[model samples]
Target: MKTEEVMSYYAHTKIEFNDMFTHRVPATINGMVHHSSTGCCSFVFPLSGQGYFTFDNVRYKLMPGMVLHINNTADIDMKPIGSEGCHYAVIYYDVEETVIAHDPFVISIDDYTTCQRAVEQMMKAFTTPGNISRVQTKAYFMQFISEMLVAHQRSKHVDREDAMSEALAFMRQYYQSGLTVTEVAERFNIERRRFAHLFERYTGINPSNYLIELRIQHAKELMRATDETIASIAEKVGYDDPFYFSRIFKKYTGKAPTAYRQCL
Candidate 1:
């Protein structure tokens, strides 16, 4: 919060928790005595006290009731915020399990009680060596990460909505001008692959499919509003081939252009 440097840390991840344990870092020490490492990731949860990570030359604050992710792909610096030192739980996981997730470097515990509970449970499981079961341990770790992913996705939905609406508006205006999904994405300066992903995430429809629906809807309006020829209507709606347009229209509406017009 209140920091731009903190956001850059969220850009990288292969998150799947490992080498986890509870460490009550003393106030006498600054931060973790971390040396250079490779192919690793760190997650921090403060049980008490406060701390922050210096990532990408920017400091991101961390406190109790929150989680932080520090990817090992780059150099990272972490420090406790106050002299009281920090009592926190940390997970040093290296293996990246294949999972569909949104990477949010920081998570607030307030809105996600399930994740908060998962952290506490995992901490206890890791510390209570004799009481740990392999199945239960894996279950807790997976559950915590799963909840975190859910929280991250939920948090971003609002921000994604504005972009989705703009994409829809662009499609509505340009559907008749022979626009493609890739072109629509380029107008927003987003790559085609990512644009399609986010577009579907927000609208539940692929960008290309949405454009097709728009074109068909416009063609229907033309058929109803005026006595336009099928070929002319097809051309006006961005289809140069009347036969192809008719096929597409029938595929979507289950009626040929003439039959649809007769229905009206």
Candidate 2:
């Protein structure tokens, strides 16, 4: 079905959030419109059929067994995709600023399959007649969010540690005089080819790219904290030519040295 047609069905459905707001919607194959709410975020689960959602002007296709989190401040538009209409279980709850603050990472259901299952189960609880108490439903919803946050934090920690260890080690020893990949490999007592492979495996970037990131990160620090000229900063970061340094900096940060320094 066309998106506009799907939205028409969405207009008739009921939506409810425990201790929040409840709404019932009728099934349709037409257009759907959503407005931003200040009190809480919305969790949408597609139990059956297919649809598509638009957020911040980006379209994301929704399939069965998928859970979508719409932020409190985001505008959402959606509609069904084909002949079958979409069925969604939605829940909204007030979120304290402190709770939001604790969640620095944006949780994406795409990564973890376990979190997807949790959302499906929550939808099932909501759809079943008199199957879940208000308190139970709230607890289950919070538990699902908590689990996703925990998994995200764990994954980030692993990635950060791996990147920091290799990058920092390389920087501390060779920051003043830039070392080639072969030199770094020799220093670490490994073959050059293997060293490149290992560095990419651990850092999610090749050795050369990681080196550039390290240099640029340090350059930003110096630019903000010191009154050094761009030329001096470039030299200190192992780039002899300030122009070359500016090019690399702009590539990574989308700003020139002077503009980046001015921002700080």
Candidate 3:
């Protein structure tokens, strides 16, 4: 095809991201590593771990910070290159026929940590489409694609952590000041849903639950150590309603604040 003709044909091409998912496939036969499913243009990133990806008879060893772009209508297989297995994310998108990806290609990300964070945000939005506003999800997707496009073009190695230690410090300092998941996440420059997921990954507890635990812990200390009224204690511990705080306290400690105080 002539360059001008090809450009004309693709001028109005549209790309739609659809059916995105994260998967971990074992190295065994049950992993479906060699499965062949055609007609989908997909983007893949190795979130962590190492894997050998095979597409169109070309083999690529993909490690953390690596990305793969597979054109529509190609056969592909990916399995762990090491004994640890593989963990990765993929998005299958539809593009105009004339602009479909033709051959599988690999790209190295320069800022892998940032890209991984974007991918995590995208996956959280993808898996639970309604968890975030549509505009927020769309923004995440656009940023995700833009970052990958830059990396794909430059082929440089870059990576670092998202650095949530500041979040932890902030939570410790503000847990008694009406802390909110959304507020804390925003303070840390992360979307609420993604922050919740990453918080659990780090602390092994839901972020809301963690905040509740903090509140209840402080409430218990005041209940035992001071002559403060239940209502006063509630406000001190970040709850404005004494009755609600008592209810949550009982749920955690199996005794109402007054009852626990009396017993103590």
Candidate 4:
């Protein structure tokens, strides 16, 4: 599912904390299956070691940076894959029947330190013997979820911006290599159309237009600095045919390459 959908689901759903516990499994343990038949959903947070959880036939790799939400009726199978035992915390909660999960999912978080602190507070409150501790436990659990969601959103935004910066750098480096929108997008493993859309959104111009503008800009620089022929200049800027390059140069600058160079 998309990140937006996951964030929306959590934002709209109502939940009440029931209880929480910590589990430690040996490294040699394998093929251990646990089913949640107690009519309560669970949020699993791994603190250390590595493992895998298979729920509803979907396998999720478990590590320090991931959190999983499983519905009450899921058949969860756990296996430790690290050299040491897996140490994790599980928070059980009840959601409104109308908002109950139809499919379990995993969330990847880059910042786990804050989550660890929240879970530790929840664990302390859960073990305390008082009505006030119960309330505190729920508050801490809610805060943890809220922080996780916000962090996910923030990290995603930063990632998109970083990817855009990298894409721009890639274009600048390869602009003279006869690069196409499709070729540049393929370098980043993005779909051609989506890549074009994102590039335009980030740069205020489509990839093809940006490439042309970039090549022309460099061509103008070369025209001023060198005595190369128009055809040679065209090839240097990634265009094979000088006549085609002249037409484009005219379109962008209202003058042919030779005329533009003479003015330069």
Candidate 5:
């Protein structure tokens, strides 16, 4: 699911902290253990060691820098992945199901040190003895949720920017190989329309137009440097039909290929 949807769900849903505890287990699981199904959602934050959780038969690896959320829907099994045991904090919270349904999800935290600090503070508050400490613990839990969601959003933004940069570089390098925008998007495993939208937002032009610009610019360079036929130049720049290439050339440069070459 998109980060926006998760943020939206949190924005509209009421979340109340129920309980929290740190669990330490041996390096092996003797048998399957069932997670609490008390109608509250659980968030698992690993502190040390490596393990994996099987939520209704679907497995998810767990370690530091990863946050896992399990709704009250499936039995969860935990097993260590290595010789070392696992230490993790599990926080349970009740969400307003009427506002938005919850699902199991695992998200990686970029600033994991800060997240660990927040978890430590929340646990401290939870263990303190007082009515005020209870309120403070709940407050810390909400702050933790808000910070995690915001941090994830920021991480995703940086990731998208980097991915778009890589995509642009790939397009510029392979533009003359009969490359299509759809093919480029598929190469990066991005959805077609979403890739176009992001490409346009990043480069101030859609990927298709950017590709056309690349081919047209290279064609102009070939015309200036080599005395090749328009058809040959068209093939060099990834166009099959010289007439079709000329039409697109004129559309972009305001002159036909032969006319543009004459001036060059």
Candidate 6:
């Protein structure tokens, strides 16, 4: 499927959310399936039956109440576990940047019972005939997004304490200045090697790489909203050399700055 087609699906899908839209798909599994367009990251909960979702060539079995996250850049392939097809509910939405900045990529909810209840409520709201107006549908979708975020945060595996707090504060303040790992470690009064290890342990990425991602993320916002030149945007994001900035931006976002701006 083309990107436009996928977007159209999101637009036309009978979804209901308070602040966002919710898409409920009932799918049958048999042969191999491929989603051509890069799908958005989403939550999938099995309401009945069983299936397996293959992502990036890894297959995960889906049982009742099982919530699976599919990456935005991945193509998902689903296969039924038994002869009977699986029935599932999928919810997709984009949270605020602040929320995403604080959350990890993958969050697993261990409390299946609570998740099942939430799914049932969402299904009830979705299937009720003439009960949801356009505004009500949109509101329910936003509510669903909020519920998913709450559940994911509650079940997050890693716990961050002193170091994580300091790291996040430091990033928010200095992300635009091209701060190095050594500088951050020095500020924390720790050895460079030890700081690297701790940062990775807490945040799941090395300090330097995280800073780079932060810068790129900010640069993307600038690109989308500003008419600034590519060189100027690079400088604002801490890169003085436009060539190197362009290369890194392409590597991160799969397009040159000009191309990205044009698309927007």
Which 10-residue window of candidate 2 scores lowest in summed lDDT? 98-107
Query: How far does residue 99 in candidate 3 sit from its true spot (Å)?
Result: 2.9
As a whole number from 0 to 100, the lDDT of residue 102 in candidate 6 is 19
Clashing pairs in 3: 110-158, 112-158
Model 5 off-target regions past 4 Å?
98-102, 159-264
Clashes of each: 1, 28, 2, 0, 0, 14
In order of appearance, the predictions have TM-scores of 0.43, 0.37, 0.49, 0.58, 0.58, 0.39
- Give one digit per residue, the lDDT tens place, for model 6 in 1-264: 222333344445443332212222344433765543233456666666556667777776655424565544566676754434566666654432212211112233435556666656655665666755544544555555446545544433324357566666766665555556775664444568987888898889888888889888889999888888998898778687989999998898899878888888
- For every candidate in turn, the CA RMSD to the true structure comes to 19.5, 18.5, 17.5, 15.1, 15.0, 19.2
Q: Which tens-of-lDDT digit does each residue in 1-264 have in candidate 4? A: 467787777788887888888888887675674745557888889988656788767877666656888878776678765346678888888888635356887676657788888999999998999999988999999998988787666555545556567678867866665667875665444568988888889888998999999999999999999999988888778787889999999999999988888787
lDDT of candidate 3 over 131-233, digit per residue (tens): 4644565667667777765654343211113435556766666666566787666444456898888888887888899889988888888888899999989
Candidate 6, residue 150: Cα displacement in angstroms equals 40
Please give, for residues 1-264, the per-residue lDDT of candidate 2 as tens digits: 222332332334333345322222334544675645455566665655555667677766554323456656666566754435565555675543322322111232223556655656665566656745544665667666656555544443344345346445755546544545654554333457876787777767888887787789889989988999999888777687899999999999999999988888
Among all windows of ten consecutive residues in candidate 4, which has the lowest summed lDDT? 154-163
Candidate 5, overall lDDT?
A: 0.78
Candidate lDDT values, in order = 0.67, 0.58, 0.69, 0.78, 0.78, 0.59
How close to the true structure is residue 167 of candidate 2, measured as C-alpha lDDT? 44
- Provide the lDDT at 5 for model 6: 36
